[model samples]
Target: MMALQATLQHHPLLRATLRSGWRERWSFSGDMLPALRWREGETGGLLPQAEEIDLRREAGLKVYVVQDRSTVDVTFQFHHACCDGAGIDRFTDDLMVHYAGLREFGKSYKFVPTVDPNRLAVRGAYGLSFFRTLKRLPGQLVGLMGAAQFWGRQPIPLLAHQARDRCTKSTKAYPALTSFLLDPSQTLALRKAANHRNVTVHELLVCEFFCALWDWQKLYGQYSERHWTRMMIPINLRDASYRSLPALNYVSSIFLDRRGDQGGDRDQLLKGIRAEMEVIKRFQLRYTFLFVLNILNGMPWALKRSVQQDTCKTSVIFSSAGKTTRRCPLPRRDGFLHVADLVLRDIDGLAPLRPYNCVTMFTLEYANRLKLNLHYDAEFVSEKQSDVLMDLFVAGLNQVADTAGTQL
Candidate 1:
């Protein structure tokens, strides 16, 4: 099932690279290796991972390329083992320089990889000194043992066929469409809006996403759902020692989920999310190490899956990007746009280890407002339902932007 679909998604380009003598680089990043399968009764199939990229190996460097035909009609996937947004951005910058030289003069540079999870100490190894200082080991509990505070889960469920929304570009634009993009001009406005709130771009983006969620839910009358959706935001881990390793998904997503389905008011939700980002960004390194500890626990299969899901549920997400460094150049300043390829899933293998009804929302980069790409399960949702969810995001963003302006 998932296996065959993975094959259809088989990037012939990647296969060619492998045949040309490529060696795969592995790391702590979530690698995309999924088994493709048709949900219960769907036509187009789904992958056993997130829907972000199609990374394949041919030599020392693993290539991550877009599966979509063009920028206008966007649909992409990712390998969870690769670096998250920021990490990949850095890798691409270096890669583009290398590629530019190669394409221009038939010469190429070899990728010198770095960092191996197999060798690193448990992330955030609170040295023995800290442990000895504690009156009692806190991780110990009722048969459960000590548990780190971070709930790190990456859930991969097989969603029912009815839940997915099939989206494709209609050459002639469709009505009720939600635009998504990373236009430089619009992004500047978003940053300015956040500044007015005394918040950073990332914080403002997080709040905007929640507002999108709230709006989508309200549009579909899902605002009263008993369960609150969990979001996962990946944080890149970089250090001098990591320079030797080939960059992979060297990131850990912090979870932002409601424990008891306690939703917040529009203003409150925005503030709460901003607060979480403020605190997490300040101590992101500690959070990454805490995640590394769980991976080392060596738990059984049941617990491993549970832990994985718990770790990821807090991070799955997609949104826009705007510059905080006001000095950043405009897209037109360089002719080509600094396009953002926002991804939310692993798109390589067809392993049953994928989560169900996974919803990845992407805002399309456009000249004006943006578009939203909701890559979700066809079984658990429909195209209309997906659009409704996006509507929520739209309403939320506009509402918050409006209020933030009023407050300022």
Candidate 2:
């Protein structure tokens, strides 16, 4: 672990995020301190929050190793201000390569990864226009107001109210988190199901998620004949044409609108999801705001706050890191050390202070296993409630798998 720390401490990506301080932009100044340590437990909360490296003063990443009776787990905590999941992927890949060289080759390894600054602008939809910016301003303003109302007033949405009687009250936001993991075999089944339906795994997950929400509402709350829900799906900009850059915030989120009034049919649901996703993938939603974000790497906090506030109208934010085809080079077992799990915690930003008004789901494939990590405001979703939703979600996926070729 000591050797691992030494290696990561020098990584260019980690160092860039660490040494840079945030204001309006990242400025290089203080040296960063990225740590590595061991704990005793199979399952435990990551490093204590009280005494530790300060993100503003130190590095935005920290690593914790836990030793259980039969397995070892590695936990990575990252400040959202510095990096996103894609950034984490790059770091993980680098870490694995470095570790493999140290353990297998017995050499002090080092390498730096470079990022293309003009990547976003090269996407063909990034040219700037004063008239376009001016036109979007009013819409952005409306979005901000809508967010404030959704988060503060907690009023029923115009479309939602027409469907059924629902309760809207502000509750203390607590951290209620959960995970739903599919073993390798189950993950394979899910892929096969998606292929059968002629849709991507992400579309399948979204369909099931919406179905699960509908099921939950029918079982626990108001049952609407026709309910309108909103979710934000972030698109990764580092694909194909644009090289994967080691930069944070290189993502743009597109909002998805779902209206489920028809009788719950898995085929219909999956079909709708696939259609919407296709539209989203095509034209790239005009690559909205990509050019703007690229220009402002570390957007001013006030601007971020304004944008985030405007997005409170969404019921959830669902992001899928897709699949990692490149295998992790870090040895799973190297005499005395048996890597059991690689856990990624999503406590980015000052989560408790201004918690997400809606639940957030982050899905990814690691070590060939599909997994989901859910983050919800505890006041809105208790532990029991979260369990119910997750159980339904898993069941929904399996149901699709069971009917793969026969159904949609």
Candidate 3:
């Protein structure tokens, strides 16, 4: 396809990977850089065929241009070593601009590479001082301990055991990932609701997630008034120097503490979460986690693995990439390629090296359309239950949206 050709030819990362490979094995040591490998496949010219991309290959990054009924669907799968969501966003932006220029101008334009060696935060001024990080380690440890205890009390023992049994019976590392596209009107209504309630859409969605989870627990007779759940939310850390640069994995996460009883008052819960996020942002607590990660980067492999295992306590990874106003190179007001829909989906079970429980939810807004992607561990979240959970999540969104006319 012309779009595919233009994307592959212009984007530096894609072009370099096409010429090189994408198997940038993750190492704390700076010995191995990222590479890419390409594969060309036909999907029988149908829908949802992009799911056929084999993520198990050692390439670490896979790009597929699937031929659908009307248009070409370009799907990308990359290892975290290549980049975090923010990095990937930048790469896709370049790809789109390249495609647009070719479509509109019929010529290849000069591409600006956003990669920066100085933008590496581990050794940069943007990162916190080691000594200061060490000083705060005790407090951080206390906070983490409290969060762990809170989460431990939440997941129902019987439910977890049953889910584990179901998962053990199945050999799949991941469940059937699902994608939902919200129309422009729906996205706008949700935004209006979020603004009216004085909460970021991120917090609003997070609250809805917990509400869904709580509903499931109660419906399944597993909910306890004394229990609470913690969801880990990734926070972007692109500061002044690196904000413009195309970098990889510049991210940290904070666990949101949701008490079981707080699910009743959605507005109140949103306010509390917004306030907590504000405090976290104002105090730069996310950099503390980055500092800890930088420390792990220098440790022995065994020690780093041990630390990661010990710290992996969250119930789910919730990522809302916010919104992007960037459009294609061609003249289009609100979308890519004028009429095509832009949807972003994560290829689950790619990184076998750092395996973790997968009840992950990702959301993003592009050209006023909001898309939701849910990837769950088949072992932990059963297929039937996954559908039910997604339903509850959507229902919760409507419930919150109903408050659009009400003040916080």
Candidate 4:
């Protein structure tokens, strides 16, 4: 705990709070360390209580430590407006380094924070050239026209029949989470399968998610022509130059739009996804979303109005925190990462739920194993249905692995 406090004292963004009123800004606060919460019990059911961190009154980040017997689970909850998944990974790496040093050197250990002045400069991180971004405008405009399929028609919800309320009435939205793990051997099989298909692991994961969700919805009689299933995948903008930056939001996203009637075998789906991703990469289209956001940032009223009028532009968000163990500076003990006296067993990345987009999926690879976590609005998806969705996703990956074993 003392090590964490010492680390936070050096990180500016982690010890900052938002200013009130329409024009908001972050102000550094020295007392943020006291807000850390500690509890006793196994961490289960990722649901946020109403009394958790309030960004308006408190700092932008909150840390919770839950201990059960000899095991410890640390959960970090932060406002999405402040930081991204990669940012959290960076912070965790720093925290582990500090903890290990403190344990070995006691009070003699000194903490030095990473310094990057351009951390908050999003455009700088992307190295966005005016002429370069402008040249891709036409292609992006065409993509926007394609995204119109989701404008008029409502995107299919995960489990609409199980909604507890017609509309989410809580002042704060808390996502309920369920997770499953893939052993190292299974993880290797999936990677080999992706290699066999000539697609990246991320593209393969996206294909499986789409196919599994399609099959699950068809089983429930929710498949139709008019409804669309649009998924948003966030792209981290930080490159090698930004490696030393602290935790902050430096991310953009690409949207994949597919109609409900577009069902096919896994190979066909993977092919289509790979082609689209190729176009996105060739054109550097992820920056298009950031360009629009930059424009909207100037007009707070229009931004607020657009969000208020949002009609489920996205059905789900799929984010991957690739190879988390590579970013940490911790030693391994019995196949698990260790920090001081505690053995780090598992790490789950939980994506925040949006207003109309009730379901969010996250993938994190740690210690040669892959873990999939699903966070959904309980009001929109039932607990049983969430379990079924997870089963379908895992089954899809297992089938791919089984096929790879026979061919390769």
Candidate 5:
């Protein structure tokens, strides 16, 4: 346990080396704590996938929940400093294990491995973090151009692109789906294809994802100027900075704005991701502290806020290692939505080196069944539009699998 906790503390990716500006460590006292708790978990069984109440933080932070329901609702409090979406996921997974008697809690749940504490690689994402300058304009522009050129080319047709026509309006209502489950077999097959292609799974997946989107566009080029949903990929620090120490939210979301297929061909996109990834992988492991020294230089105050709002604009955010939503589902709550289970597993262990774009499915898990939660904006994507998206998502999944030669 000492080793695990220490490892948790020591890994650079696990630790939030970024200064929180506050002199004092965070305190989770008062109304800031959870407002409700259930003595018996919502699940009739030993473990549930997602707990109710939908308590989470911004940019997918992490929280610890304990049900001394007899006590006040304030028991489940979290320190925003170190916890992240992945971290929360890990906590929930372990909690469920402990709850289910599969894994003991506390003393029973102590295992630690050695880790290196460094953040330079992960820190480099903020290119402006270097040069002590305000605008990362140069790097951003270069990266943007490279990314842009990569995407400018079209590979897939449109009608099959599920992301199109769905986000004309934003959703803040209940989640549209229950859970995002991966067909481990399908994922494995895709990985193998990527390996055979000599490209990364992420590169191939991104390529395939874009191809699928393009295919949809070809069918119905709704607008004269083609614009699709901007995708976000979470870069995990495991391969680059540190090895598998369950760090909560040890990830960063990199935006890939495809204005009519900017990704270069099969060769270029893979190369760019690999090049960028390699730089990060090297910098984050040993000299992340140096990168930290440059942050204030890279991003000034106003710019930082803009970045936060644009990139981290999810209605709910969480991090878990595994077994997210394993806790039994809770009754519905006001002002809250369901869980978004994002599974980005390299089931085939292919292209661990190349970066992959994120594929997230937001859903509601009730009674051990996963349902997609679609929060729709009445104006643009009506219930009808939401339905279209649902159908398209199914279509997209199937098409992608078929394209990758898998039995959907």
Candidate 6:
């Protein structure tokens, strides 16, 4: 507990609180760290759901520790306005390192605090000059127009039955989570399959997700040639220069729009995604989203009104948090990461759910194993439907792995 608290003191953003009014700002204080919440039991088993954090009155971060006999599970929940997935990973790495140092070296271990923690702010992180942003404005405008046209047509939700009307009446957002894991062998096969096709594992995963969604929706007779499947892929904007920055929101997204007819064939869909992703990377088109955000930042009323009237622009938000182990300072014992006496068995977290964008997919690779976490708004999607969708996704990946083995 001491190490954890000490670690939080080093990151300014962790202790900051959100202050809203005409203009919102983050207020930081030395004595504002949230007390750690600890529980005893098997966190993996069925249990009563915890209440959601109210960011307006509390800190933007929450830490919970669950200890069950010999196993310990730690979960961190952060408001999206304060941090991104990469930021969470970075913070976890620091926490483990702190705990390990305190346990091993005891009194001799001295902690080093982050220098100029205020620099972690998203300001100037996009690396876009005023002139450059102006140059990109036209292209971004065109893309927004294209997105508006698609949204005007009303893209179908992942589930066949719509619950937006019923869900809107509820004051609280009830987000539910479900997850599955691929063993090292299965993960290896998937990687090999990606290599055989000259595509990245990330690209392959996206393609498989699209295919799985198509198949799952077809079961409910939701498949239509006119319907479009829009997905938002978050792109981390942190380059080598911003690598040392603390956990914060330094991410943008690239939208992928595909018609039902376009995603019917797996190979063709993969080909199209690969080419589109290449173009997005080659031209650094991810900055286009950031440019629009910068413009909105200056107009507070416009941003507020947009959020209040926000509709689900995309079918799903998919984030691939690749290889978390690489950034960790702690050593692995047996097959799991160990911090002092605690063995880290698993790491799973949910992406935030929005009004219409109820379903979000988060993927993380740890200990050479790939884990997929599905988070959905309970008001929007039922628990049974979430399970079926996850099953289809896993089945799609297993099919790819099996095909790879046959080729071998």
- Scored against the true structure, residue 94 in model 3 reaches a CA lDDT of 63
- In candidate 4, position 399 carries an lDDT of 80
Clashing pairs in 6: none
Better of 2 and 6 by lDDT: 6
Candidate 3, position 148, lDDT: 52
For model 6, the stretches where C-alpha displacement exceeds 4 angstroms are: 46-50, 113-116, 121-124, 129-153, 160-174, 297-300, 406-408
Ranking by TM-score: 6, 4, 3, 2, 1, 5
Scored by lDDT, model 3 comes in at 0.58
lDDT (tens digit, per residue) of candidate 4 on 1-408? 887777666556777787877677787777765366788887654544524456767777777777788777777777777678888888788888889889889999886666463556553437656786677787777556544543555665654533233354544356578898888878888899889889998898898898788877878776665567889899998778778777778789988877655656667778999998998887667777776666676885776776666356677899999998586667886558888877788887788777666678999998888889998777767778789889988888878878667311
Q: By TM-score, how accurate is candidate 1? A: 0.55
Report the number of the highest-TM-score candidate. 6
Candidates in order, TM-scores: namely 0.55, 0.70, 0.72, 0.88, 0.47, 0.89
lDDT of all the models against the reference? 0.40, 0.56, 0.58, 0.75, 0.36, 0.75
lDDT of 2 by residue, 86-189 (tens): 76666666565555556654655544433443443333343335685566555554444434443453322211222211233344433456787676677778
Please write out the lDDT profile of model 5 over residues 83-187, one tens digit for every residue.
Answer: 444444444344333333322343564433233334434433433344533343333444444344434543221222223222232233321221233445665
Judged by TM-score relative to the true structure, which candidate is superior, 2 or 5?
A: 2
Model 3, 1-408: lDDT tens digits are: 455444433222322222224533322322212232333456333223222222233323456565545434455665564467776776666666655556555655554544544344352445556686576566565445544554355432213432332223345643356566677778878888888877778888888888888887788786866654667778887766566555366677787767679988877888888988886765556765555566666786844574544333555678877775353343455463342343333222211111334467888777667878777666656778778877888888877676654211
lDDT of 3 at 14: 28
| Residue 6's lDDT in candidate 3 | 40
- Residues 16-128, candidate 6: write the lDDT tens digits: 88789876787888888764688897866532344555556677787777788776667677777778988888778888888888998996898765334667554564766
lDDT of 1 by residue, 1-408 (tens): 222122212122212222223434322223333323222332223322333233443212232222333222111233444334333333333333333434444434343322243333433332333644242233222112112344333222222222212243222212112233434554556657777777776666666665555545565455544444556554445455554333244554455654213445545765787776665555333244343446465554644556444223332365332221122122322333342332221111111112433456544332333334556544445667766666655555555456434211
Model 6 RMSD vs true structure = 3.1
Ranking by lDDT: 6, 4, 3, 2, 1, 5
Q: Which model is ahead, 3 or 6, in terms of TM-score?
A: 6
Model 2: residues with Cα > 4 Å off, grouped in runs: 1-23, 35-37, 42-55, 68-70, 107-175, 222-227, 241-244, 262-265, 289-305, 308-311, 325-358, 404-408
**How far does residue 229 in candidate 5 sit from its true spot (Å)?**
6.2
